[model samples]
Target: MNGETLQLEIKDNIACITLNCPETLNALSMRSLIDFHASLKQVIASHEVRALLITGTGRGFSSGVDLTAPRPGLNPDDPDELLRDYFAPTYQLLKDLRIPTVAAVNGVCAGAGVSLALSCDIVLAARSAYFVQAFVNLGLVPDTGASWLVTQAVGSARATGLMLLGEKLAAETAADWGLIWKCVDDDKLMQEASAIVNKLAVGPTTTYSLIKRLMRDAKNNSLRDQILLENECQSLARKTEDNAEARKAFAEKRKPVYNGR
Candidate 1:
């Protein structure tokens, strides 16, 4: 699926979603968010896609919402409407996707952009890229799940500082603070992200899906409940064809080939 502000391409079982509006540093307008939500639905409905990667063209991953962009019938002055109608659903779709999701941050990720990147299962950023909580600068508080996502990754203290100060957080520092999976050189960012996505695409995708669910549920579950959930998930994983193939391959002393069943 493709649109003016976004592009979606699937190849070798991996789906790549690119933010195409580079002129404004890939700042997402209402139209772009609509396109993005549609593209994600396409990915979810496709059986051929096993892994998903999100990135952007030219310079940045995304600079967040374009407050000045026009959307018919929507009140621009009321941020609540936009968040309820667009941003909330999009982020929920991403979080609930059955397949693994990766984000490649190529440049500046500010405001909601930071939440978008951090929402993925794994996030990799270019060494030169940085994140900023730009909302405070506009006299607004962080929205689009930033308040929760940031606080969950880093501690409350760091998240508070970032949001209140609206200072740039370097990619390397983000990694060190456990906000992202890794930070690579600018030229190698795509390469690393592609490598990770490709690996995930060919692995036991059913297991990955279960793992993703378990991790998300773990945040709110007590240790006793989490253990039960893991046991249940493991039972499900063990019933997949890929698990049988893995056992057979182990006995044969050869690498297992997964069909992502």
Candidate 2:
């Protein structure tokens, strides 16, 4: 949390994480990745955190891994092993984070950076922002869960094209391709992402967690099983005070104040 590579701050049940390595275009370094993962786990375990927002501190969100950093391991010759563990934590933390996460991409997101943005529950990119899979250009394959996450978001064919061609997809084009949630003005990205996080922070916490789990499991669940799972979730949700307040507010023709119960 005290590292200069990243900054983490919590307020109003929302944790904001900013990747801070502007000189290197906020490139993902090993130490930074480890610190970020630790910080995320801390926030997720804390009872006060309800939502998370991740962004960058410079012009670009990130240029992907910091190639200048020293490779780890006894075999100083094995670059493959080093690359495998480089951004491993970044990918794992995103997938394991229980709280709803949002990515506010303000600029260029290349290589593993695209995967990082895609890992978030919702990705809000600025008009000036662009996504690129520069791995092929560098004579490397996609890492940090990019291969799966990218294909999952935009399908296998598009993912293949993006990775192989190393094309830079603009924010609007990425949105059109269903690669990101939405695109806004250069200056409004953070504001819009903040509003979304505020909404989730005050909404149904338990139901949101359940819905996240259900959706992830949907990839493997049969239709009948999914229906049953939904039934169970709904049955549980209906008993919460937030649900009761919703019904009361509807009957009274007023807005409900959810406590995220």
Candidate 3:
């Protein structure tokens, strides 16, 4: 993974990934996106990382794709194939990360950037931050799962408004609309994100992983199906080392030390 465009660091069982090309508002160049996927792979493969935090440097999380860069649709290549090979993999990796993932939106989050933030298990934004679909303004449709994520987060009506108008949604307004988890003071964004991720790092990670999968499947699942899935997951959770540790700690009247088993 190239560190120039994407800064990555791991500490205390949490991996912090930052989009580093601030001058371009951390826009995703083809190479940058590749490197980002590589970095995510490294984190996902590591046993030491139990949680992930993603953000960006400077005043924007990302302006989405670098418009000046050569992109797929411009060429004769099938756009669907291009998406499947290049864009889809990165998004799929994020969705299947199998760990608690958090997105800290520090500034302007737009276009595919909106999808990036929404891909996380939890999304927190700065009070000054704003989200924009921005696709219609560019005469392009939403990509990188933006359509699905936004529609699911908000309803079809709001999703249509955001996508069609491409207006800016302030962070506070986003929270009120249930588009994000919460909006913190701009200065406290990183501090709050760090606190949240640090708490997750030592949490019952196996259970968290299960919860992540279930939550994603929840929307698509029937009530009976989800209940059955929950039972199975709970059964699996009971067998995890963390569950045993918690039980032992409870019996001993001590705080449980979770190694993210």
Candidate 4:
């Protein structure tokens, strides 16, 4: 499904969802978030889609929620109401996707935008791109799980500094701090992200999903618990057709051809 605010296209087992409102730096207007959820539903229902990639068409990935334009039902004055009604559903939907996800940050990523970027399984940003934790500047705290995400990625010290200072973090610095997977040149952002998504789309889909689940829960798991979870996941992964093909290809000295079983 296509909408004025967001665009969705699926091909070659990869589902690409682009934020289309470049006018506001791909701001998450209520209309855009609604379209985003619809697109996500379509992606989730598609058995043929193996991987998902998110990006925006403009000089910024997303500047976060549009402060100037409030939706008819959402109340910006009430942060709890805004989070419950608008942000939580979309964030939970994206987080719950049982597929590999990559967020290709083309330019500026700030406020809730930073949370969106970190929500993905992997994040690749253009070297020229920057992340801003501008919530404090607006006398607000981070929402959309940004506090947990940033703290998990860079530890509480850095997260606290970032949340309090609200400084602009360069993409390179972000990568160095383990905030993103990598930093590429501005011109190569799409190319690199496409290559990564394409590779994941054709790989062992079951294993990738399990990996996502495992890692997502790792913070709450002890080593003993994680080992048990890994063992359980391995048993499930071994039953997939892709795993059999991978074994057969190894025996035959050939590249594995996965059908995303």
Candidate 5:
């Protein structure tokens, strides 16, 4: 499926969403956000999709929101309504997806684009790709969950520095700081991402969903509560058909072929 600013394609149970506005470095205009939300809904409704990959075309993942684009019904000075109405819902949907998500960041990722990449379950960036919190440069603060995402990945000190300084962070440095999952050669970015996503697509879907929930809730939960949550998730995972297949395969000394049950 294709939208005005985005393209969605599903092959082999993997759904790929590409930001297609390369002319503006794939900037997220209002239209793009609307299309993104719609595409996510389509992914959710399509039971065939087991994994999702997000990336951009041309030289950048995204240059963040299209500041140059005209906002018809929004205040020119304030972006409050624009973010709440257009950006937040799409971001929330991405975060709440049951399937695994991978981000292939090819080039510049700035402002809300940084947040978008970080929202994925795994973020793999090209060697040449760089991230920047450009909000400070524009005299604005980080939005689209940038503040929370960055701080969660790195600690408060580094997040503060990155956001306040608004400096370019190389993909390697980002990986070193644990801000992203990995950094690959520029030419291998998509290849590496696809390999991981393909593995996830065929793996135990229920277990993966449970893992995502556990990790997402871990930081907020106390140790006792976290353990209880893990116990609950493990109980659910143990009941899945994939778990039984895995056990049978182990006993037979063969690799398990999961049906994503």
Candidate 6:
């Protein structure tokens, strides 16, 4: 899928989706959001797409919702409903995707942009990248799941500090705080992210999906419940052709070729 605000490309079982409005620092324009959902839907429908990566095309990952752009005609007192309608589907789609998703943040991520980056399964930020919660500065609260994602990654204290103070966290500092997976040099961000996606693409995709499900739900489940889930997942995983092929390959001292069964 292609659009004025986004670019989508697929190669070797991996899809790369780029927020393409570089002139606006790839801010979350309405068209961009719609295009994002369409691209994600296409990727999720592709059985061959084992992994996906998202990044921006210019100097910044994104600056968040484009305040200067025209939005839907909603009553000023009920703006929440309009924003929700535009953002929720895409956010839900990202969370529901079965295959792994990576965010390669090449530069600044602020406001809803921070939410977008955090929505991915793994986030790789460039060394020069920065994450800013600019909502408070504009007299707004974090939206687009930023509050939940930030707290999930960095705990309430740090998330609160970021939202309240409107401070920017450097990528390295974010990594140290467990807010992102890793921070590579600016020039290496895409390459590193590609390597990660490539690795995940060749791995046990079903196991990865199960692990993702379990991790996302673990906080709400008791230990016994989690154990039962794990046991069930393991049982299902063992029945896959890849599992047996892996075991046979080990015994034969040969490489295993997975069929993603």
lDDT of each: 0.94, 0.86, 0.90, 0.91, 0.95, 0.89
> Which 10 residues in a row give candidate 1 its minimum summed lDDT?
70-79
TM-score of each: 0.98, 0.92, 0.95, 0.97, 0.98, 0.96
Report model 4's TM-score to 2 decimal places.
Answer: 0.97
lDDT of 1 at 186: 96
TM-score: model 6 vs. ground truth: 0.96
What lDDT is reached at residue 255 by model 6?
A: 89
Instruction: Please give the distance, in angstroms, between residue 108's alpha carbon in candidate 4 and its true position after superposition.
Output: 0.8
lDDT of 2 at 88: 73
lDDT of 6 by residue, 40-141 (tens): 989988888999999998899999999887665646787676468778878888988888899999898998888888888999999999999999999998
Clashes of each: 0, 0, 0, 0, 0, 0
Please provide, for model 2 over 88-195, each residue's C-alpha lDDT reduced to its tens digit, 9 standing for 90 to 100: 755777776777889999998998788888888899999999999999999998888889888888999999999899989999999999999999998899889999
lDDT of 5 by residue, 1-261 (tens): 889999999999999999999999999988899889999999999989999999999999999989987677777678588899889988989999999999999999999899899989999999999999999999998999999999999999999999999999999999999999999999999999999999999999989999999999998999999999999999999999999999999999999999889
lDDT at residue 177 of model 6 (Cα atoms): 99
Q: Which stretches of candidate 5 lie over 4 Å from their true place?
A: 73-78
Candidate 3 Cα misplacement greater than 4 A, ranges = 70-82
TM-score of candidate 2 against the unseen true structure: 0.92
lDDT ranking from best to worst? 5, 1, 4, 3, 6, 2
Q: Which clashing pairs does model 5 show?
A: none
lDDT of 4 by residue, 1-261 (tens): 579898899998999999988989998877887888889999999988999999999899999878876577766587576667768898889988888999999998999899998989999999999999999999998888999999999999999999999999999999999999999999999999999999999999888989988998799999999999999999999999999999999999999999888
Task: Give all candidate RMSDs, comma-separated.
Answer: 1.0, 2.0, 1.9, 1.3, 1.2, 1.5
**Which has the better TM-score: candidate 3, or candidate 5?**
5
